[model samples]
Target: MTQVLGIVDIVWRGRNIPVEKGAKFRLGGIKNTAVTYGRKVGRAQEFQGSEVMATTELEAGQRWGNTWDPGEGELQVVCDTGQTFVMYDAFLEGDIPEITGGEGGKIELKWAASAPEEIGV
Candidate 1:
């Protein structure tokens, strides 16, 4: 039988964020291309992933924005198939996560990576 792959969790700055069930989790496929003319002309490769929902606690008389801004550090996504993706130099891209009143509650955080990530099995 073939084993299925599943995203176990999303860890940032050494913290395991509680992700919502059925949340959107996608890894942007590795891409390579060459630029004909531009500022930086050369072959380039990119590695990125979709937003990783991070569970948060909103309390009354509390603030948002900078207070909840996840500075930057190593971001990891572990899979059930013993696959791990590590973004060595990564930081929070967007200013703040989307806010809305609905099911449970979740914050969508962009997995912005500066360079190629290290894939381990």
Candidate 2:
């Protein structure tokens, strides 16, 4: 079966926290960043099957190693899910970014894949 996936854009607002040596630290939101992409599969699915079919990652945004100085305020991120998230610690080097808001933070993600082309065998 063939299927088409629609592209999605996300937007949110929150705070950015800085961490040292993997230890959590508190920081108020003073930065602004954004991420955008297409539909993606959930990470939990990886355990469901031996061979992973669909996988996607985040791109076109700030990286983890790259230091961001939001500069005296708070930080917020807008995602495709339509839920605004306040970032606590941004792990840019990994496959995803860890964000927090209100009670706590969760991982935010985006993904995309090209439609396969058919060729006569």
Regions more than 4 Å wrong, model 2: 1-75, 80-82, 94-121
Clashes in predicted model 1: 0
- Return the TM-score for candidate 2, rounded to 2 decimals: 0.17
Error of 1 at 39 (Å): 26
**Local accuracy of candidate 1 as per-residue lDDT tens digits, 19-113:** 55443445555677787666677877776544443454444554564325666677787777887777766677766666656744445666666
Residue-wise lDDT of candidate 2 within 1-121, one digit each (tens)?
6433232222112323222122221223233434344664333211110110111232346453333233222223322334333333333332444454443333333222122122222
Which one is best on lDDT? 1
Best of the candidates, TM-score: 1
Q: How many steric overlaps does candidate 2 have?
A: 19
Q: What lDDT would each prediction earn against the true structure?
A: 0.61, 0.28
lDDT of 2 at 106: 32
